[model samples]
Target: APLGISNRDFLQQRKVIFDFPTKGVTYMHFKSIEHPEKPLVKGIVRAETIISGYIIEQIQDDPPITQLTVISQNDIKGLIPKYLVNLASGKAPKQWIGNLINGC
Candidate 1:
């Protein structure tokens, strides 16, 4: 989700933490939106982890989307878009600090 990533790759590799609002379950993965014809793996997070840094790139479509990229402790890379992210308790990347403070 860096500044110059393509939309296809952005959608395929962004990390997302999915919290089941009513089920009390949490899942984390490199999110891939479900497609109609073929099924793609939704990177499911099975362990507890904290993401320290993120590279975010946003796309302004009819429904704007944000791409989130993270490098895991094991050196694995993951990506997810903003719409798929649950921002309730998550913090924005360092690059976004100024924008957040400016109320943008």
Candidate 2:
């Protein structure tokens, strides 16, 4: 299996692991999750943002990429980097703060 664990095991181990923002909470300068290979766009989180909900969805049955979904305000579904996302807490890293502030 891609994930090394069987599907049944993966599902059994699955838990709400990340500190997901509440359905409507706005995250400032939210990065795009859809395209990892391409440059990321700095997105502003607003009340009107159309996030379907944060979820760790299974992309591949084998060697699964730890991808998370981020629905845009325009209702477009995008993928987020699982590594950057703090599964333990929803806190942004210090480096991300600088990037967000400087628009780096």
Q: Which is the leading candidate under lDDT? A: 1
Which TM-score value belongs to model 2?
A: 0.19
Worst 10 residues of 1 by lDDT: 4-13
Model 1 alpha-carbon drift over 4 Å, by segment:
1-52, 74-104
Q: Across residues 1-104, which tens digit of lDDT does each residue of candidate 2 receive?
A: 12322221100111243333544333332332433344333452212223333344444657865444443332222343454333412442344345645993
Each model's lDDT: 0.40, 0.34
lDDT (C-alpha) at residue 29 in model 1? 44
Writing each residue's lDDT as its tens digit, candidate 1 over 1-104 gives 33543222222334444443223233344433434554433543222233333444554556977655544332123454544343412443443465644895
**Alpha-carbon TM-score of each model against the true structure:** 0.20, 0.19
Model 1 residue 56 CA deviation in Å: 1.1
Clashing residue pairs found in predicted model 2? 2-62, 2-63, 3-63, 33-79, 34-79, 50-73
